[model samples]
Target: MSETRPAPLAGLKVIEISAFVAAPLGAMTLAQLGADVIRIDPIGGNIDANRWPISDDGTSIYWASLNKGKRSVTLDLKSEEGQKIATDLIAEAGTLVTNLPARGWLSYENLSQHREDLVMLRLNGSHDGKPAVDYTINAASGFPIITGDDERPVNNAIPAWDVAAGLYISNGIIAAELERRSSGKGQEITLALSDVMLATVGNLGYIAEVQATGKTRGPLGNGLYGAYGQSFATSDGREIMVAVISNKHWRGLGKA
Candidate 1:
């Protein structure tokens, strides 16, 4: 006999109307945790459907990787009928996760009027009502400047802000669900990519140090910040990166 395991979000349902990284990744996280996630894309698919990192056969590996374990539906959000259908689905699911702007038919005020206990999680680029993306946010948050070597600023290979913001949005959804259980009212949660990166920079004490001492942190190539760490080449021509952050670790590395 096989053992049966229950998922944490088995009974939860989420209607995800989003494209690109952050919102889709957040919905995918919820789906992986056993939420019934219904992803509504545009008629011919959203912007990410044909995004890069594709296979030779034109399949978008990037999109597939992020959109796993979710049911998909296509609709023309611009049309009145399509809008009604989306609204119906949203009302039925009682939860929506989207990275689109909070306006038009998808606005919290418009949706909440239909279902009072509707939980809507909106992901945006900036909190100041300005448009932004992962790369822009990364640059604006001062990460790119301190990422690479001392030569010049380099953008990161990974969309760090997008991934982090996605996880944060997922966490927000879970917390909102818990709150709704007791309050019997759904709430709107808004997350911005820029805010997430800024918060991360602040949490790491980078922003505080700059504010207090008026000093800018420079980039350290392959070295850990405030620690004894660097990459070294072995005698056999092999490379290894090591970090000795504590006294015990330093002693252990020395002994080795």
Candidate 2:
């Protein structure tokens, strides 16, 4: 598969200053496609470091899986000297990624100052004044209420909002790079978990419009809605979803 890769980012360097799944995963994808990815770790490691699945050699497989093809360098950005190192790295780097909020990371602003041509991907919980984590984003966007059994609605089993925001951030970085090739200027990309969930729920934006007009949309059971969709139990006792939109197919299925 390596032989087939075109490696669009062969000479580009990316500095990833992020913890946990989302931001790291984005940087890793760029690295796999041939970008030189450098992970910036805090002196004592980030909070999410070594939280699970330790190998015999004490290496965290969870971390390795997400950060496989990247180099790591530790620095204490809180100190003046450490901040200088991070700023220098960013000035040399073509792209930078971070999940930490701008307010929390003082060096982020400084790096931008030093490298005006640096493309940045900043991921955070919320774009608004509020914090935008997985659970809070899900609830506010009505994603939880639309999920799970009717007895009690729940959030998704996975951290989908975070992942989505990261992917969006990655794409934004690439797009910004493309624009820079034409215009010769860098860009800052921002993504929030809540905005990502809201965009996902936008598939049912019409429903939201109706609800706002004094109509309520709730609990669609395991039956067809408006004679088009149905959720049936499979032979293995699992639910299989089928959607029939055309009248011809509906009639052929004996749904008269």
Candidate 3:
């Protein structure tokens, strides 16, 4: 095992009103750093307790992994008493992380009334009002076009976009916390899945440069765009990734 580092959020208090992978991972990250996190679930329960890969007794190991080291409470947020409890909890909480639909539910307006300084993170599927998922998001961001062979485009097999957004949200939350320390005021941060996907594409600037000139990028099967890179299957059925650093290396490999 690696050496343990000091917990950065030793005295912070957070309340998580979220389910699913993105926001829960963010909340768990904070808790791992020694923050006090209370996970508020619906009275009927937010997580689907009957999903796959259960224990011998039928407990959801997936939920347990994401929810380790946190306190949980069941509440009915639609009820008058439940809303009151949430409001009070927000007033006392140093941070709030949630992924629920923001408009009809507890809007920033309603929550700000309770405590203007409460730090909030609202995660969404789209920047506007359109609902989206990982595949659709990857498609919109130009990742899928250059994903597969020329014959067909393929969506990424992993939920890379969602995981990226979760990490970015966690970092943004801590940045907001630092800003709060200096300014004595908290903030509200919004991260959308669509926006995150777009940002991921932006990291590869060559793609944008090509698109700007009325030309589009394409999938270079088993090779780099203008250079040499290969993703190949070995005789043992294992995958190997190799990239050429220079013309010399390319020529040497070609000869070999």
Q: Considering every candidate listed, which one attains the maximal TM-score?
A: 1
Q: Model 1 — TM-score against the truth?
A: 0.95
Per lDDT, the best of the predicted structures is: 1
**Tens digits of per-residue lDDT for model 2, 216-238:** 45766544546667788889989
lDDT of all the models against the reference?
0.90, 0.77, 0.81
Per-candidate TM equals: 0.95, 0.80, 0.84
Candidate 2 deviant stretches above 4 angstroms:
1-5, 52-61, 103-109, 203-208, 211-213, 221-256
Number of clashing pairs, model 3? 0
* Model 1 regions more than 4 Å off: 1-3
TM-score of 2: 0.80
Candidate 1 vs candidate 2: the TM-score winner is 1
RMSD of 3: 3.4
Report the Cα lDDT for residue 62, model 2: 81
**Tens-digit per-residue lDDT, 230-253, candidate 3:** 898999999998889898997888
Preferred candidate (TM-score higher): 2 or 3: 3
